[model samples]
Target: MECPNKEKNLNRCNCSYPSCSRKGLCCECLHYHLRNRQLPACCFPDDVEKTYDRSFEKFAELVMKGKI
Candidate 1:
């Protein structure tokens, strides 16, 4: 199968994290996040993505603190 990233036209995603396994496939991306008890990259703003806290609990904390 063709890679989903083939259509992204991106040299790099703005996810900011260097170690994300969900770098391209949107379906796999969401699945990975759900399996890991975390939110996907789309939930975060630019600044928050820089922090690299992808956990659901951490995202909730950000909401509670009005950071995201």
Candidate 2:
């Protein structure tokens, strides 16, 4: 039950938002994000995620604008 992928990504991941409960465990990470109507950290690049705006609406806006 070890999430090696997520754990490993932690070292290089640019997700600096506070209150992130899924520092590891990709599955749980996705679940947590989606449950809140937002995309996971991995979906965005460093600069974008740095905005600390993890919302599904924002992600969709970026997608529609082809900025993501």
Per-candidate RMSD, Å: 3.0, 2.2
The stretch of ten residues in a row with the least summed lDDT in candidate 2 is 6-15
lDDT of each: 0.72, 0.77
Candidate 1 C-alpha lDDT tens digits along 1-68 = 65667458234456666876556666777787789887777778767777867788888988899987
Superposed model 1: Cα runs more than 4 Å off: 3-13, 19-21
Clashes of each: 0, 0
Let me know the TM-score candidate 1 reaches against the reference structure: 0.64
TM-score of each: 0.64, 0.72
Best candidate, lDDT-wise?
2
